[model samples]
Target: MVSSSSVKIVSKCFVKPKTIPEESKQPYYLSPWDYAMISVQYIQKGLLFQKPLGSIDNLLEKLRESLAITLVHFYPLAGRLSSPEPQKPNSYSVFVDCNNSPGACFIHATTDLCVADIVGAKYVPLVVHSFFDHHKAVNHDGHTTSLLSVQVTELVDGIFIGLSMNHVMGDGTSFWKFFTAWSEIFQAQDSNKTNDLCLKNPPVLNRYIPQGYGPLFSLPFSHQDEFIRPFESPILKERMFCFSSETIKLLKAKTNQICGTTSISSFQSLTAVIWRCVTRARRLPYEQETSCRLAADNRARMYPPLHPEYFGNSISALRTAAKAGELLENDLGWAALKLHQAVAEHTSEKVIQMIDQWLKSPFIYHIDRLFEPLSVMMGSSPRFDKYGCEFGMGKALTLRSGYAHKFDGKVSGYPGREGKGSVDLEVCLVPEYMEALESDQEFMSLVSL
Candidate 1:
């Protein structure tokens, strides 16, 4: 946790759009994927920007203005959350009340910390949490809770924009769409062609029609307790492992040589390496069933291939399960092939079946249960381009999921700063396991300090 004294919260308030969105005065029901997280709170993320060229106050005012404008277009973000059966405590059929929200939470904060103090170093303290709303992480603030909470923190060297959006409303893809929209609005004020600017594809709020998925039954299991052991501990640690383009090339080549196939991608290769390292470091039993849950984006794979602007949760993960000895003793390509096949098998028909199965089984049966011991899950996508979200100030040097997304046996993947074939992984785990991974010679040799 970040010390309260480190970042001073100067002011906090809600900012609505310059004009209300007339089209969304009614309640809208979220899809099954979105509603599944109603009890989990928002998806928290942060961005790092180099110091802007103008006065801090002016820059903030511009941001506030742009945020209001952005909300007009992304009206769903301005909605409040509610369940269809308010009296039923376990009801997971939650909906977004678009007519009731005042606006999103916006905070103006200042800190003495600098970007250099946190960005590159392996052991920077909890600066990311200091920027967002910690109170709302596990509990709902009130009935009028803002779907989105954005905090702007200023330091001597740079600024951090932290976002906490209700996961029931959107996933990373939708969040980035709104973020990029806000950036574009902020930059259009100074751009040469302000009127000509337009988002590539406007957000489509209609729930994606499941072609083959049916006979849903998730509402009853929604009452089950959330599987939260992986997220809790006496001490939670976060670290970043950097893999350069050259290292990734080497890894891909190694995987190809080991698997006797030339089709492995950078993601497949790197995840395989980390999966093996984690399993070896944990020193689990030879027969222990270890699983690597790889996040698979379902946007381009939908039956109709929905547009990138299609909002809400469109993500599905693939599980690659194997014995500890298989991963620890076998060639890297063995794990790589498992991962590659798992991800490759998530076709349109497969996603529909997955949704169907999920609706019939326990809520969180597939994803959250996989968080049990001896399992690793990967998060976020490098394709979303977190670094490309450039406001009027500049492009983001780095962006992270922070503590909001951290858990033991979890890894977050991000594109390298240069956007080459490189990848950046943020790893979180128990202290002993981290110590074990730190000492693993093979893992150390492949990573850039």
Candidate 2:
């Protein structure tokens, strides 16, 4: 197991939004997506469990005190979006609420596993599900806003803590940093040595200052419609899948052999296979069609390794085109190569610089129609297992993406460190396509290997 000290902390300085008067001085306006992300930095969540010798009230008091230094922004819509600018100050307040009576705060001091378990299960879904709801519409202010909510639920035998935040506020990396800090505070308070914990500097906020003109600059739609609209939907479903680590390694090795190309990473190869499998199962026409886009995190490419603590939205997308037939007909090597090229070309400094420019353009949103329908959203090599799984009771057997709406396909893959060549992939596809792929002998063989 890795020690917490070894984990890197990202800076959070830039996450705080400047006052309206301060922001008006700048010539450029924050893209709608960026504006929403900035608001996420001010929100916070805490988990209070009943330990063998602990009182829940004591824990809550300690947590409230410990978090005093950080600003806590809250909204009334527990699972919906809130306007960025509230008509009145203190329109919404942040306070703890119990499951039995959500409007009233509950402060109980007890230690019970059953209580913890029920709370944990409920909290998990509550925190994750809220994001999808908030993104669907703008708040009362007419500006698109995101809400942050905290729910306390009972786990199977212990209390589970859940935090829900808007994606526009911060990306996964930034959110993780906030979580780790919160955990550290809780741990320090539990041990009665809060002063020993060191607080790091916050992240620097560098607005996407446009560089030379790129694709986003001449786009056909508004900035809000481009990135935010893709994620809007009223309802969503969640699913989870687990694969033995050994199976993933074998598949990667096989892909390397078939592709005859050492340049492809395991992630690219796996995504290509999934794309082909889904398309074939759906019996979708492949000729001259581009049906998918990959959500690539631009962290490393933008500034070497991204600081985990740097909060706010710092991501970009890469578009790929291929006929369904070509992907299915190609060997693993060919598919892997195509995937690699599609991803790699966009990793260049030029591409990132171009994206920064496009986001700043007033016409950024107008270009959405030029692209093909985005069928799948894929993210590879996430470090879920290595993150905070240990803090929650038993080790997490599997980590999967929460339910998401809007997109027809979603998949995330991460390496399993314990097993040789093993990878963990969580896929979300339409029921029909999922059923067809499950029944396909060739597709099953590839995934199972």
Candidate 3:
């Protein structure tokens, strides 16, 4: 077993597209939502793959070749985030400089660690950082010149593909789009016999949200057009708890019995249980108001209805609230009902209202609001089929977010590997709170260690 103390970097280099796609030559506009994200690097996602069907060198070569080909279709990733002309004093339009830029940094590293060394550990995996490229601090422009970066780390028994993308560039939806494309290219061996690769479904780049939303400058939130908060040290501990198909079924059935209705989904049921447990574990006062923010993907809910391939931040923040007393005192159904209603309220018109609101004030409400007590934000999708990414290799052994998710109270859920109605919760909380959650009898009963 490789000692957990050190992971060695073998090589590091930039891989630009063989030729910049013509479409990428123009500057891609940043919508109000995109602009809200410029100051914070909110998302860094990663995946771990076991042995592929080739030698380590051959696999790395194919990965690099396929990545170059894939960058052609997703050209925006190959560019840098830039600020243009002085529309106002110290005020400028922040847009992606897609013209000429060095492509993403590709990192190759080796770790004596095994995949199981982290994922299989008893204490909880804090080793997610081993899979990422080096994070370079931003320059004076207050924007990261690097939009996308890749780090491929070789473990004793597997490979980890870490992708780090700026939130301003796009959201999780955009990240997954590029991920799926790279996966396809890798599987098909993007470099054919002669080595030519292109995306079959090129992203329909839509910078504007189909409304007269103002660009990033119009937002009233930040002064000098930026917020550069020092990176506070994070005190986070993550533990994965798997809820089997049987437990979920029981939760669903129990929730229906408590609510006298069966309309709530398994997701709603589990979210309610988690909220209640977290609220109680945090020891918030009975009267304290606690909220769970469910990220609503609005690709299909927009007015014109964005195509599934439409790229950009397409998230609608949906929230459900309850006092700690009411949350813990009542049967789980009440919380489920609140959560269900919160999600159900996001009709097409509601999405348009959110759009217009951003047009009015382009700032993202959730960026700096994390770490607040009594607030929990949901971060991924069990239904997004994250399990399907296979690049000439077996599927990922276990896919998880980077260490950036260590913010207090951020909760992530994905379908369990058992597949029949199972769910897994990757919960990050204070050490004591996590201990409380682990000791929670009702909650622990449903969790599989």
* Clash counts for the predictions, in order: 0, 43, 0
Q: Candidate 2's residue-wise lDDT over 166-274, tens digit each?
A: 4544555555555555555555555676555454534333434344422111223223334333334323332333345565556677787776756667667667777
Pick out the ten consecutive residues of candidate 2 with the lowest summed lDDT. Answer: 10-19
Give per-residue lDDT, candidate 3, residue 325. 93
- The alpha-carbon deviation from the true structure for residue 326 of candidate 1, after best TM-score superposition, in angstroms, is 1.6
Tens-digit lDDT track for model 3 on 31-137? 76676565555466677788565588888888888888787777777777666556555344666777667787788888877878867875555556656653423
Full-model lDDT, candidate 1 = 0.74
Superposed model 2: Cα runs more than 4 Å off:
1-147, 197-238, 286-288, 303-309, 356-360, 363-374, 384-386, 389-406, 414-422, 443-449
Ranking by TM-score: 3, 1, 2
Model 1 alpha-carbon drift over 4 Å, by segment: 1-4, 85-92, 134-144, 192-197, 209-218, 221-234, 358-370
CA lDDT of every candidate: 0.74, 0.44, 0.73
lDDT of 2: 0.44
Better of 1 and 2 by TM-score: 1
Return the TM-score for each candidate structure. Answer: 0.90, 0.64, 0.91
Off by over 4 Å in 3: 1-5, 134-144, 190-201, 212-225, 230-233, 364-366
